[model samples]
Target: MKLFHYIVTNRLCHILSTIVIAILISTTCHAAKTKYIWQSSDQFVALEQQDSPSTNTVAPNDHPATVTSETISAMLSSLEIRATDSDKPEPLFTAVAVQSIAPQILQGLRQASPTEDVTFAVIGLHNTSYGFVKSHKVTTGRVYYQAGRLNILIGQAQKEVNDRDDRRLAPFTPGSRHKTSEGDWQLLPQPGQKGFSLQRKDWAAFSTEWQPPAAVQSVSPQQSIPAGLIAPARQPSPADRLIVLKELKEKGLISEEEYRSKRQEILNLL
Candidate 1:
């Protein structure tokens, strides 16, 4: 009776050990399947498992598409950004003049890395209580591609309008992104706002209206001027310099003393 009991007890121990080993293998495989392709403080792009039912997952058949210059232009024109003081949102590019320089804004998205970002000036019209106002703002945007889908995040716009500097308005900032739905691209909301969508057909219209103007030649200092037609040297206005200095301070690029000194200098110029 003792011998039989000993054999049965040994068999039971072996079975229990087998069960534990199997469980551990399953847990490890599940953990391996879940990973983040990109992440930030408040946002992330993760690779989901096939069993996940999340709507954010990209379909298997939908391969990742390279973002083209046209894509960038279309995305920028479709953005519905509103200033904090404005009542209603408006397309970031309203006037043809602002749209003409869209090509110059396509930096950072075409990088070889899977994750990248770009910052550019945003010129748009906003409707205030008084009337329509033109706003020159600055914003940063991040982009990444994973598992056949593109993810984008656009930061809040900083009101950095310098009316005296036409060149500041010429630099463009690319906008945010979301999944493509029925041949249309959508703009995912920044933190506390509702999302917006734009159709592919609409992009065609925007591209046509936003054709860039012919390149202008710059006058070199070495070039000779007419005997009586010497022109005053062009320089950034005091207001423009002050705006740039303020931006540097806000970005933590300059010390308080430096910012104050530069600000005073610009003020003195006025």
Candidate 2:
């Protein structure tokens, strides 16, 4: 009877050990399978985002729509614009007819075939009016609206240069007079406008119309240079000058030739 009890206890212990080992192996395999699934899904999602176009974040005020005074106003406001001139009143946005914008500029902005004649709009903000070209129901380009008429500033220097309420409308940057089969749709500075030219070149005039960078006050060269050339009153030392020159080059303020020339001049002075 003692021998029979001992044999039964050993068989029971062996059975329990086998059950525990099977459970451990099964759990580890499941955990590894789950980890692999998660890794593969994360990689697929990351690849999709990389291939997609940059998403345009919706502004607090943005409401996507076609051309209209009310809609254009909302669109301009959506840009979160600040006034260029403090004295200027809030602008009243207006929709422009499809025919008003230059054909080349119009065509360039709109690539959708079966291109319904797109109606652009002029929005007044930042002290001047900007042409709003629509693409996929969003304002794409801030053009010079209606040549020079809508661009009048609160205190314009050239008040004499004016456009009639009724006039042929063109873009701020119109291509040169030279004939091209598709029309000179090339961007600004391509043909380059002369300051003296009678034609309204608002492209050059208001190139910085949209959110002109904050004004930076600069010291005049004469003010910085001492009255006497023998010794500079405010001139930086050679080491300081080299540092400044390096900074200017890094910031793209000076050309390579100018940098080399100025550096040599400073060295010679030392």
Candidate 1's residue-wise lDDT over 230-261, tens digit each?
56665765655665676567668899999999
TM-scores for all predictions: 0.32, 0.16
Give the per-residue lDDT of model 2 (tens digit) for 48-157.
Answer: 00011245321121112122333223323322212333333332221221112234222322321221112222211122233243211111122222222111111111
lDDT of 1 at 214: 27
CA RMSD for every model? 16.6, 25.9
Once superposed on the true structure, which residue ranges of model 2 sit more than 4 Å away at CA? 1-73, 77-89, 95-161, 164-171, 174-270
Residue 258, candidate 2: alpha-carbon lDDT: 97
lDDT for predicted candidate 1 compared with the true structure: 0.43
Q: Output the number of the lDDT-best candidate.
A: 1
